[model samples]
Target chain A: MKWWLIAWREIRWEVFLDRASLLRTAIFVVIPIFFVFGNRGLPGGQAGEATIVALALQSVFFPSLAGVSLIAATFTAEKENGTLVPLLAAPIRDFDIVLGKLIGMVAPVLAACAVTLAAAYALASYRYGAERIAHTLTPQLIYALLVLSLLYLVTTGSVTMIVAARVRSSRAAQQLAGLVIAISAAVFGGLGVVASQLADGWALVAVGVLLVFFDVGALEIARRVWQRGEVIGRI
Target chain B: MIEVRNVTRRFDGVVALADASFEVRPGEIVALLGPNGAGKTTASRIIGGILAPSEGDVLVDGISVRVDPNGVRARCGFVTDQPSLYDRMPLLEYLAFFARLYDVSSPDHRAVELAKLLGLDDVLAKRLGAFSRGMRQKVAIARALVHDPPVLLLDEPATALDPEMAQTLRSFIVSLRARHRAILLTTHDLDEAQRIADRVVVLYKGRVIRIGATSEIRAGGKPSYLLAFAGEASAARDALSRIGIEAQPAASEDGLAALRFATDDPRRTNGAALRALLDAGIEVVTLAAEERSLEDAYLAILAEARQ
Candidate 1:
C-alpha cells in the first residue's frame, strides 16, 4: 500500500533531485548517441547485423548496470542514513518496499534504454532503407532482445537488492554490486566470444536461457532471505 | 493503548532486553527511564512494531505485533532517538511524506498542522539538511504526530533541544495525553521524566525494576538540598550539629563552603538549618534544593537491584 510513498520518495529525493543519479542517467544518454553516430559510416544490409549485435550488447549491459547502481544505492543509502528504518516502521509491508524500490530504479533506466534503442533504430533506418531495416529487425529477434533486456534489468536489480540487504554501508553495497556485475560482464563477454563460433539463433537461445535461469535463481534467493526485521536490524 | 508484554530482545548471543513489560493507556504518559543499554530503545522499538522482540509480544490497540505488524505500526507514531530524515527534502515535505504514509486525508494540511504545533512553521520551506539539531528534532516530532495516531513512541524526544524548546515539547506531550492518546517516551533526563510522565518505568539491564506513578517512584527518598556558603565550613557543620541537624561538608572552592543536607521535609528542615547557619555567622551565599529528585530514586533502585 505504501509502494506509492516509497516510489514518491525515491523520485523526489533520490532521482529528480539527486546529482549523482542525474549524472548516471546522463551517462546512459551519451552512450546511445555514441553508438548511433559512431556506426553511421557502416555499410547497409549484412554489415548492419554487426551494428545491431553491438547495440543489443549495449542494451544488455548499460541499462542493467545502471539499474544495479540505482537500486543498490537507493536501498543501501536509505538503510545507512536511518531513513529506511522509519519507512519500514511505517504501516507498509516489506515486499511493498522492495517492489517500490525496484519500480523507482528500473523505470527510469527502462525509459533511458528505450530512448537508446529507438535512437539506434532510427539511425539504422536512415542509413539503411526501411525495407532493409525491417527485414533485419525480424519480430523473433526483437522479441528475444526484449526478453533478454528485461531479464538483464531484473536480474541485476534483484542481485543488487540481495547484496544490499545484508550490507550496512551504502558505498560498500554499491561497490560490491558493481564488482558482481563486472564479474558477470566478464563471464558474459567470454560467452559472447564463444557464441561467435556457433549459429546466431542457437547462441541467442543459449544465452537467453542462461540469463533466464540466473534471473529466476536471484529472485528466489531474494524472496527466501529478505525479512523486514533482518534488513532493518542489520542497518 | 499499547501493551508490551514480556518483551525481550537479543542480538547474536547478548541479551539487550529480558522480560520487559509495560503499558501505556489513554490519557497517560509513560516515561521509559533507564541508563545506557538498559533496553529503553529496544522496548520502544518493539512497541512501535519496528523491532520484533525475541521472547514476547506487543499489542497495539488489540493488534498483535507479530501477526499484523503493519496494523500495529499504522496505529502508532514513532520518533526515534535519531532524526534520520532525507536531507534532500524540505521540512514540510518530510512531514507531508509521513502523513501520506499514514494515509492521512489531507497530507499537506496535516503537515502544516504538525509543523505549526512543533514550532516549525517558519522553516517549512528550508531543506532539512540546513536545519539545526533542534530543528531536526522538531521535524522528527512533527513527523511522529503527522497522522495524529492514537499511540506515540518517542525515544528521547526532547534531546538536543534548548530548555525552552524542551519545555514546549513537554507541554505538547502533556496536551496529547489530555486528548486520551497513549504516549511512551524514553528519556535519561529524570527531571523531564518527572515533569511530563504520569508514570515512570525504570529499566536496568533489560529488566523493569520499577513502574508506577511519578509521585510513587519519586516518593521513595527524602528531599535533599545543597547549601553554598562563604564562611567557615567547620563552624557551619558544628552549628547544624549543635541544633541536632546533620550536615555533611561537601566541596569548598575559593572561600565558599558547600554543605549537603537531607530531610524528610525540606521546607521545615531548610529553614532551621538556614537559621542555624546564619546565627553561626556562616554567610549563606546560595541555598537550593537539588535537581533530579527522580534521579535519586532511580539510582537507589538500580543500587538495590544490583545488590
Candidate 2:
C-alpha cells in the first residue's frame, strides 16, 4: 500500500514538480516529431518508408533512454540526498520499494513514448495520402513497434533500477545507466535491422512473448539483488 | 521502553561496540555519553533499528530488532545530526509525506501540529533547502515527531547550534519525556547530558564504563570544601600549612578570604580545620563542601578507564 503511495509520489514529482525533467522529456519526445515532419513532401519509396519507420523508432528509443534517467533518479538520487534512510526506516518491504520505483519510472516514459508515437503517426498520414499511409503501415510492423517499445521500457527500466539499487552514488548510477543504454541501443539497433526482414505476424508475436519472459527474468534478478542491508550500508 | 542487551557491533573486524547493555523506561531519558569513537552513535543506531548488531539483540517495546526490525522502526523516531530532507519540498509537505508513509490517519493535521510544536508555523511553506541549520534541525525534529512514536533516538541533535538555540532544543527534548516516551540521547556534550538526562551511560572504547543516576555518577568524584575567612588570606594559608593542611585562596573580599581544599572525607577534615583556625585566632566565616561537577566525574571516569 505504501509502495503504491511512493509510486504516486514519484510520478507526481517527475511529471509536475520537477519542471526540469519534464522539459527534458518534452525535448526528447518532441524533437523526433519535428524530424519526422521536417521531411514533408518527400517522394514515397522503399527508402522513404524505411526512413519513416526509423524516425518512429527513434521517438520510442529516446523515451526509453529517458526512462533510464527516471529510474536512476528515483532510487539513486534519494539515496544520495540522504532521504533514503527515513524512507527505509518506514515499515516498507524491500520488494515494494523496487516495484514502486519501477512503476514510477516506467509510467511517465511510456506515456511520453505514446505521445511521440501518436505524433509520428499523424505526421506520416499528413506527409503521405491516407491510402498511401495505410498501404505502407503494416499491422505487423505497428504491433512489433509497440511490443518492441514495451520490451525496451521493461528491459531498460529493470537494468537501471538494479544499477540504482546497487550503486551508492546517484551520479555513478546515472553514468553507468548511460553506458548500459548505449550498449543496449547498439544491440537493439542490430536486431531491428534483422527484424525488418521478418515482418510477419507470427515472428512479431514470438519476439514479443520472448521479451515478456525476459522482462520477468530481469525483474526477478533485480528483486533478488536489492538487499536493504547492502544498499543502506554502502552509504 | 527500549532495551539493548549485550549488543555488539563490528565493522571489518574492528569492534564498534561490545556488550553494550542499557534500558530506557517509559518517561525516562537516557543519555549515551562518550567521546568520539566511543560507540555512542553505534549503540543508538542499533536501538533505532537502522543497524543490526553483530551480536545480541535490541528490543523496543518488547519487539526484538533482530527478529522484527520493521516493527521496531515503526515505533521509533530517529533524528540524526544532519537530517537528509528533500530540498525541493516545503517543510510542511515533507512532514506530511512522511506522516502518510507512516500511515498516520490525518497527515495534514499532524504536519501542522508538529510544525507548531517545533516553532515552525511561520515557515511551513518554505522550501527546506532555503532553511538555516537551526531551522533545518527544527524541521528534522518535527519530521521525527510527526507520527508520535513511542520511542525517540537522537544522535547529537545540537551539534552546531548556538547556546540559546541549544537550550531551546534541550528544553524541547526534556518536554518529550513528559509524554511518557522513552528517549535515548547520544551526545559528546557532558554538560548537556547532565542537564537533561535522568540517567547516563558512559561508553569508552566500545565498552560501557558506567551507568547510573547522574548524581550518583557525580558523587563518585573526590569531595572538596570551600572555606571563607574574615582575615588576611596569607595568615589563614600559613596557619593551615603549620597544621599540615593545604588550602588555596579561591577568592578575596575587602576583609575576607575564600579558600578551597580537597579531601577524601569532608566531615572529619572540616572539623579539624575549623578547630585549627579557631585556635590560631583566624576567624572562619563559612565552610561548605563544594558540589561535585558532572564534568569532573566524567573526566575522572575517563582517566580511570585509561589507566
Candidate 3:
C-alpha cells in the first residue's frame, strides 16, 4: 500500500505533470505512426506481415527504451536534486521503494506503448485494407506485441535501475540506459527474427520464457543492490 | 526520547563518526555542533535510521535502529538543509503524500493542519518550485511533522534563510520543545544553537569532545569581572597592583575608568580588590562580571580538542 502511494506520486509528477517527460512520451507515441505508413511500400501479402512485425518491434523497443531512460533517471535524478536522502529517511522498506519506483516508471511507458500501438493499428488499417490487416493479426503477433513488450519493460526497467543506483549522475545513468536499451533491442530483435522463421508461436513462447527468466534475474539483482546505505553513500 | 549509544560509522575505511554517544530526552533540544567534516550529518542520519552504524546502536523511543530500522524511522522525522521537494507538486499534495507515507490517519487533514500551523495556509495550492528557500524549508519541516513523530532530527534547517526567517524558524523550533518532541539539531550556526538549544554536544573530528548545558559550555573558562571606577587610570592600576591583582584596562564609560580581570574565587578576590581601592582612596563605582559568548567557548573548545 505504501509502495502504491509512492508509485502514484511518481506517475503524477514524472508523467502527467512533467513537460519534458510528456514530450518524450509524445515523440515515442508518434514514431510508431510513421512506421505504420512506411510499411505500405511492401507487396500485398508480405506487406501486412511486415507491418505487424515493424509495429510490434516499434511498440516493444521504443516505449521500453523510453521506460529504460526514465527508470535509469529514477535514483540519479533524486540524488542530483537532493530528494533521495529524505525519501530514504522515510519508514518505507528498501524493497518497497524499489518496487514502487519500478511500477511507477514502467506504468507510464506501458501507457505510451498502448497508445502508440492503438494509433499504429488504426493507421495501418486505413492505409492498407481491413482484411489485409486482419490477416496479419495472428495470436502469436498479438502475444509478441503485448506479453513480450511487458517482459521487455520489466527486464530493461530492472537492469536500468541497477545502473541508476550505481551511477553518480543522471546523465551517466541515461547514457548507460541507452546502452542497455541497445543491447536489449539487438537481443530481442534477433529472437523475433528467429521466432518468425522457426516454429512460429512455439519459438515466440520460448522467447517469452527466456524474457521471464531475464526479468526475474534482473529484478532480484535490483532488489539486492538497492540498499538505503549504498544509495546514501553514493549521494 | 532519542539515544545514540556508542555509534560509529565508517566509509571505505575512513571513520566518519567514531564512538559517538548522546541522548535527547523528551521536551529537550540538543544541538550537535561541529566544524566542516565533523560528521554531524552522519550522526543525524544514523539516529534517523537512514544509515546503519558500523558499531553500537540508536534507539528512538526505545525502538532499536539496528534491529528494527523502519520501526525507529516511523517514530522519527528527518529534515535536511535542502528542502528537496518535488517542484511540480502542489504544497498540499506534497504534504499529504508524506503523511500517507508515514501511515498517518487522515493524511489530508494532517497536511492541512500542518500547513496552517506553519503559516503556509495561503500558499497550500501553490507549487513548491515557486517557493522561496525559507518557504521550502518550512514545507520540509511541515512534511517532517505531518506524522507527528516523537523524535525530530533537523540537519542545518536554517542554513540559507534570511535573518528574520531564521528567527521565525528558531522560535518555531523552540515551540516544538513544549510538545515533548526530542529534537536533535545539527548546525554550523553557533548563535542559532545558543539561542534555542537546551544543551549542546560539540563534535570534533567525529568524536564528542564536550557535552553540557548551553550556559556551561559558554562559561567554559575562568570567571572574569569588570570594575568601573571614578578615579584615574594610573591610580586604578596601582590600587589593583598593591593587592597582587593584575587587571587589564577595559573601555571607559561616562568619564569613568574601568578594568577587567579574571579570578578563580570571585567572592574573595573581588572583595579584596574593592578594599584595596578604598584604602588607596580610589572610588570604585561599579563591579560587574563579564559574559563569554558561546562562539568564544566553542573556539576554545575546538582548539583544545585539536591538541
Which candidate leads in TM-score?
3
lDDT of 3 by residue, B108-134 (tens): 999999999999999999999999999
Top-scoring candidate (lDDT)? 3
What lDDT does candidate 2 reach at residue B270? 82
Candidate 2 per-residue C-alpha lDDT over B1-307 given as tens digits, one digit per residue, 9 for 90 to 100: 9988999988778898999898999999898888899999788878878778999999999999999988988899999888888888888788998898888999999999999888889988898889999989888888888879999999899988889999999999989999899999998888898898999899999999999998899888668888897777788887777767789879665567898888887777788899888888888988888887788888899999999
Descending-TM-score candidate ranking: 3, 2, 1
Residue-wise C-alpha lDDT for candidate 1, range A141-178, written one tens digit per residue: 66666566666677778887888787788789889888
DockQ for the candidates, in order: 0.63, 0.47, 0.76
- Stretches of candidate 1 off by over 4 Å are A40-47, A186-220, A223-226, B91-93, B119-126, B222-247, B250-292
In model 2, state the lDDT of residue B162. Answer: 86
Preferred candidate (TM-score higher): 2 or 3? 3
On DockQ, the candidate that comes out on top is 3
Q: Per-residue CA lDDT of candidate 3, range A30-149, in tens?
A: 777777777645465675577566775686567667788888888788888988787888888888888898999888788788777767767777877666766786656666587777
Shift in Å, residue B149, candidate 3: 0.9
In model 3, which regions exceed 4 Å deviation? Answer: A44-48, A191-207, B230-252, B255-257, B275-283
* DockQ value for model 2: 0.47
Report lDDT per candidate. Answer: 0.80, 0.82, 0.86
